[model samples]
Target chain A: MARVQANGVDHHVQVLPAKGAPLGTAVFVHGAFIDSLASFYFTLGPQFAEAGIDAVLYDLRGHGRSERPPTGYTLQDFTADLDALLDALRIEEPVHLVGNSFGGTIALDYAVHHPERAATVTVVESGPATQDWAHTMAGALDQATEQLPPEEALDWFVAEYGAIASTRQGDGRHDAHIRRLGRNAGKFIATTTIARDIPDGRVLSDGEVRQIRCPVLLINGSEGLVAEQTAWLAELLPGTQVRVVAGQKHSVLVEAAEEVGALALDFVITEADKAAALEASLDAALEGGRTR
Target chain B: MKAVKATQTPPIPDEAQVLAEISEMIMSVLGDYAPPEGDAAITLDSRFGDDLEMESIDLVTLSGRLAEWYGPEVNFAEYLASLELDEIIELTVGRLVSYVARSLRTAATAAAER
Candidate 1:
């Protein structure tokens, strides 16, 4: 666990180094609100490290252990935070950006803005920050701002989601974790301008999104909010691969971590191998020229 | 917050000491959301999820505390990665205590040899 000063904010960051020399680095951007770096820490972070990839996980501003400013929750702010974080870490090489939900939006925006630094873009249950996205986010945040303040609403959220969590885990016991999520979300909503800033944030035009030059992978649940966007995204970013996990929903990362981890591991390894091969061939060509 | 030098490592802690440390870490992480029964509720057989109501995030915080207290040899994330999702869900405090005790012993032996 490390507190990194980036973008003038104290960000909670965790770097899981690979067992040996790292093949590459994958920065995991977690969802917003109730989610944090912990989502990746327990799931894909270790897996990535064990597979010889350094996994970087960090809490976005206003969430988890990161310092929460009263405002500046714009998508641009998030993208800049990621940029400053990489600089703070002194990571100059291109990195694979893996994002979930709102984090994916940030990743997409970052790729659009910093195409040189992003090796590949992988989004799970997320989409780009477009006008439609802003509209949807406004409504959701407005609802959260309205409902999350009341004690009864929090209780209801705990009861409802706790049951779902238990059922999903097949534990047959209600989980108090839901309460933690509810309370944290409630506090965040009540205190910050995230609700307004996110929607009012800068959105990407189709042309801007089309500027992403890296390999892209989009994974979404069949019932997830962004599953339909897969086709449109692929059209915008040619050669984008879309994988829809059947009978799943927005919580695909937690619900199907093993599957998602495997897919991610394979993607990174494949991309790394291609990069290695390209480097080796270039080195050989240079050696051949020297011999001549 | 005990500081141990790499060259002058202390004796391996017993399971009881490890448990005490873990319990303290748990309390620190849980804070206001700690169980009503308090530290006493955290026993050998206490399941983190069911009994302590710890989510994965809590474990992440606890993992950080573990590293701070026990040093890098007791890698909670790597230890957890070795387990299946179900095994992690059903993990017990005793299981963690044993792992920490064993890791510390190994580290101590290596330090003495050095």
Candidate 2:
């Protein structure tokens, strides 16, 4: 656990390294609106670490324990924040990026903007940053904030997810997280600014997605709210691998932790294997040429 | 989340004392933030999220403190893995108190046996 000063804000970052030599590094970026590092910290980071990939999970600025500047909630701000954090951590090599929901957008955008720094980008239930997405998001956030006082909204979130207290919902830790995010969400106006700026910022044109040289993985839930977007991404992004968890929706990370974990682990391991083989082949070729 | 079955025990921990200690640690971290005062009732049912007003960072800080006091034998990582993200967020003081008690009991027993 390290408290890093990145992009002029203190970020809470937890790094989990492999038990042995790490095969590679992957960073987990959480989505906006009542989310935190805990989501990935408790699930993906540990699993990736177990599989020998160094994993980094950090609280995005204005969420969780990170310092909130009351502004800079746009995707650019977030991407900048990520870039600074990576630089602060001394990550010189190309690293894998796994982002969820809004984080997926950031991951994709970061890869596009800094192509040389990214080895691959994996997006789960990623909501692409587009004008249409912005309006949908604005409407959803307005509807949500207007519908319930934040407290009541949290209660409804808990109730809808499952049980409260020591019951079944807490059994999954979903209820617990909603409560944290629900409370955390109310403290910052950045939440509102982000909802406005992102759609307005006009993220990810077709050409940008086309320009992403890194390999991409697209994952979604069967009944995911972003079904259209998921389909669009899968179709638009060349060679994008897709997996949809049956009977799950937006919270696939929570509902299908094992499946998502296995998929991520498999992807990283396979990629590592490929890289190793490629390196070996290159070495052999160079040695043969030298001998000749 | 499944409990790490207790294998040994020396005695029961004073839940009251443990709760008070946790309360102090939480209060210190949350100082000048999260309303900055009040919510004095640190009960078994008082959740870290709702009642204590513990943020995600607060909880992470508290986990480190708890580990320092409880030692590595508690298998905090395993305990966390057992719960859903929701359960960790919604966790109550009572649940943690019990977890501490159980972990210590088992650790003590194992040490005696060893």
The TM-score leader among the candidates is 1
Evaluate candidate 2 by giving its C-alpha RMSD to the native, one decimal: 6.0
TM-score of chain A of each: 0.92, 0.88
DockQ per model, Cα = 0.53, 0.25
Interface RMSD of each: 2.2, 3.7
User: Which parts of model 1 are misplaced by more than 4 Å?
Assistant: A147-149, A155-175, A286-292, B31-41, B50-55, B84-90, B102-114
lDDT of 1: 0.84
What DockQ results for candidate 1?
0.53
Tens-place lDDT digits, model 2, residues A1-292:
5899999989989887776898999999997766778767667877888788899889898787787766778888899999999999999988999998889999988998999988888888875687678787777656555677766766665565343111245453445655655555655532447655656665788777788887788778786667788777767885888888787777787667778888877876887788779999999999999999
- Give chain B TM-scores in order: 0.89, 0.74
* Candidate 1 CAPRI assessment class: medium
TM-score of each: 0.88, 0.80
Q: Write the per-residue lDDT of candidate 1 for residues A1-292, one digit (tens) a residue.
A: 7899999999999999987999999999999888999878878898999899999999999987899999899999999999999999999999999999899999999999999999998899998988888898787666656755578767765665544333353244434556667887878877888878899999999899888888888988777778556777899888898888777667788777778888888887898899889999999999999999
Residue-level lDDT of model 1, residues B1-114, one tens digit each, is: 443445555667799988988987897799898876634568999999888888777888899889877888999987886676668878999999999999999887887799
Where does candidate 2 chain B have its weakest 10-residue lDDT segment? Answer: B1-10
Q: What is the interface RMSD of candidate 1, in Å?
A: 2.2
